[model samples]
Structures are given as structure tokens and as C-alpha cells.
Target: MSEAAEKFETAMPAWKQWQEAPWGRLRYAIAEANPLRHFGERADEPLRVLDLAGGDDGDALRLAVRGHHVTIADYAPAMLTAAAGCVAAAGLTDLVSCVEADANALPADIVRGEFDVVLCHNLLQYVE
Candidate 1:
């Protein structure tokens, strides 16, 4: 595998495990930084939001609950799987989409400007 792909593979287990924690769930439910504030007055619109490195905690789901269409993107398949369950449980399946994708090289399926709100929380620290 390429270096980036290998890194993602290695990171999957730890990411999955972390998502099982209470703190993880809490953090996702209440993101440290409020996205609504950053979106400014435009928050009223039907926003397309991207939560990069969203893991399985469902921060994207929370955003969706607030009337945004959110995409939960993560490099780990396990994370995506768990996120799917979370989305379903929250009845957010219609508003949230979980995608298996790296933060560094986001998939082409995620179009540029496709998202009005892009969250990179806790992701940049790992990338560099």
C-alpha cells in the first residue's frame, strides 16, 4: 500500500476504539467549537456540511439535527460503520451520509463547494 494508505490502515483500530468511549460520544454531541457560530448568519440555509476525520462519534449527525445536511468523512472503515449505526439511531440517516475517505485527500465524490460548512476538528493535529 502507499504510505498514506498504510497510515490510514494502522490508525483505524485506535480510532474505532476511541469512538467507544463516553467522552468521544460527548465530544461529538457537543463539539468543542460551535459550528453554528462560524457559519455566521448563513446558518439559516440548508447547509451542506463536511466533518473531516469525524470518526464514529457522530458530530456530523449533530450538525444534521440542527438542519444541515452533513457528510461524516473518515479514513477508517470501522469508524464509518459505527457512524452509520449512530446516524440510524439518531434518525439522521436522511440528513447524514458517512463516507470512507482520508482527510488529506478527500474523495472526488465530495465536490468542492459542495459543503458550506467544513469541520476539520481534531484532524489537522494528526495530519501534520
Candidate 2:
């Protein structure tokens, strides 16, 4: 892992806690509406989405609900665990995949252009 990846991993626990708070919920609600705003009506299609640094993956879940195939990637194991739980709870296991990966060094499959849309939000602020 890189220095930045290590810092993020160390902060994951605190970040996970905040993401369960009311303010975090509000942010998630707003993020969930973003794809529709950008993709318009076609957001509901079975498109492939790569959600990089997708902590807890709430936005990805929203996309999965719309029948999109989503891969939610984060460097934090705890975040990926939470995201996996959310995916299971939403009954979107088939539509969503949770991965522990750094955005700077993405997995080979992802580098192969497996995704139609890359959703990278609120992550660069933490990177050097």
C-alpha cells in the first residue's frame, strides 16, 4: 500500500462511524440522486459502474437498485465490510461487488475497461 492508502486505512474506522450518523445519511441521500442527474433517464439501465473509493457504497447501492451492475472499491477493509452488509441487506448481491482496492492501483479486471461509468467522489481530498 502507498502512504496515502495507509492513512486512509488508518482513518477508516472513524470514517465508518461518521457514515452511520445523520449527517452522513443526508450526504448519502444527496449522492444517490447524482447518477440520475448526470445520466438522466438512462441511469436505470444495466450499465456497469465502478465506484472508486466508494466507502460504505451507499451511492453504489442506489445504482444497483436501479438495475445497474456496480463494483464498489475502497482501500479500507472495514468500509468494504460495511458496504457488503449494505449490499446484502438491500438484496443486491448479484448486482453489486465490494472490493478492497486502492484507486491509484486498480485491479487488472477493472483496468481492462470492465466498467461503463467510473464514479469517483470525495476521495482526492485525502490523497497527496
Error of model 2, residue 112, in angstroms: 0.7
Query: Candidate 1 at residue 67, lDDT?
Result: 78
- Model 1: residues with Cα > 4 Å off, grouped in runs: 1-33
Write the residue-wise lDDT of candidate 1 on 1-128 in tens digits: 45654575678777656666887667665673477767788777779888888876457766777778888888777667778898899888899888878777777888564677788877877777
Query: Against the hidden true structure, what lDDT does model 1 obtain?
Result: 0.75
lDDT of 1 at 115: 73
Give the top-scoring candidate (lDDT).
2
Per-residue lDDT for 1-128 in model 2, tens only?
65665666688778777878999888888887776688876765799999999887868988898899999888877678878998999899999998888888888877886777888787888677
